[model samples]
Target: MTVVSSVKDLEALTLTIVNEFDAGVDRVWQLWEDPRQLERWWGPPTWPATFTDFDFTVGGEARYHMTGPEGEKAHGWWRFLAIGRPASLEIEDGFADANGEPDLSQPSGRMRVSVEDLGGGRTRMTIASHNDTVEQLQELIEMGMEEGMKEALGQIDAMLAE
Candidate 1:
């Protein structure tokens, strides 16, 4: 129940998910800093993610796969563009091929993750996904990106609780 709200702005070609956690910024930031913690909530409940490789530097790359209930796997990769540490991160996120290489045939997006200290051991986290074009945004939406993101983010509360 960490998610406060989710908004999809078609006109701006962005999808933003806002969440609040009853933990300090540094503690909440571990959700991204630690790959194991990330794997626990990076995907929807029905599709659990496993990070095969992770590097958190500004120019680092993270490769992962989400396995569906039916045993199907969806590959993804994130190339970090900026890392502000316990506060914000920006990356180019894209679908990947079986070999974990970026699949240009699939639309990619820029994702910005921001963590704000709400004080009193509380933190506000925001994930903003920006697509390059209207068509690309529509395509992601058609793929249930909104719902998937919501479900994925909803798992964060349990992680924080742990």
Candidate 2:
């Protein structure tokens, strides 16, 4: 597992996960830049993500769904707020309806992702998921956000190795 740390800071209303990859920033960047690469590891093995529309630009939206082992589907969407090539990105992530449209009933959160070259053909990726309130943060943690993300990110090392 590449995850060095997974912290849920209710004080900061953020759930942050840090991972180190045995690849350069540019190489790791492709995981997020390309929808195909992203879908390869964006969800846990039991529930794989499949992107329907991916526009990798500021203000662009990416919509996808994770199909569970039982044939159930969990929809999701991301709107890019900021994109810094090979470095950082900020996006609003949320649950979506069956049609892949934003599900307003579910809370929407902002996630900031930063990639840093650790040198020696290695890199560090820090992802901070920000919630609007402590209640919201606690709610997400209770929903197993931390564990789900850890599982989702666990597949990255294998993909990077390829």
Candidate 3:
């Protein structure tokens, strides 16, 4: 189990997930660089994700959908704000409508992902999700974001092994 821990801070209005993988930073970074690898672990096992459009560059966008066990779909989109190769990435993430457009009515989160080389062929990944308000943060938590993220991240270990 590579997922180390998850912490939610109401005062900071952020959720952070830390994971340590038994692979090099570059190898682990490929999970985000390659759409196929990304799709394999972007969502929980029960709700596998499928990326329709993925542009892993600054100022680019990514559109994906997670299909639930009952065949229901949850659409989402990401607007890349910054990218620093295998080290870090910053993006604005939000829910999208069936038409693949962002739903302004819903709250969006600013996410920063950082990958650090831990030596010994190990990498430590940190995902920090920041919300605009505590209420919004609570809303997402109530919606099971923590568990979903933990489950989603748990899949990465297997992907990296292969």
Candidate 4:
């Protein structure tokens, strides 16, 4: 219910999801700045993420895996491109193998996360996932990235409450 809008811009080959939170910008920022905190809601309830390596600096990278209900693991990686504390970040996101090698078979994207102070303790977080081609964007959507993201973000409200 915290989501404000989720739009897919086919022309731009991007899927943009916007979320609004009742908490302060700082509180929301911590969700991404802290690896442990990020693990709390980075995946859907059915698949919880565990971070193996986290280097949250510009040019640094993070490696994580999401464990499903049946204990299946989905590996992923992120290379930070730009980071603006409590405000914005840009990263190259891709699927990886257990050994941390990129999975070239899957489509990768550049994800931009922006946090805006909407005043009066309200904050807005926008995530834009961009792929190089329309087919790549469509492929990711077919893989349930949008729904997975929605389900993943839905948990944040309770996290902020705590």
Error of 3 at 155 (Å): 25
The global C-alpha lDDT for each of the candidates, from Candidate 1 onward, is: 0.84, 0.83, 0.84, 0.83
What's the true lDDT of residue 6 in model 4? 99
Clashing residue pairs for model 4: none
Model 1 lDDT, residue 70, Cα:
62
Please, what is the TM-score per model?
0.79, 0.79, 0.79, 0.78
Tens digit per residue, CA lDDT, model 1, 26-66: 99989989999998877766677898989889899999988
lDDT of candidate 3 over 72-115, digit per residue (tens): 77788889999998999898988788888888898789999999
lDDT, residue 4, candidate 2: 98
Candidate 3: global Cα-lDDT?
A: 0.84
Weakest 10 consecutive residues, lDDT, candidate 3?
139-148
For candidate 2, the 10 contiguous residues with the lowest summed lDDT are 139-148
Residue 127 in candidate 1, Cα distance off native in Å: 1.4
Candidate 1's TM-score reads 0.79
lDDT of 4 by residue, 1-162 (tens): 899899988777788999999999999999988999998887766677788989989999999888766677777888999999989999998878877777888777899999999999999999998888766555444333445565567788668888
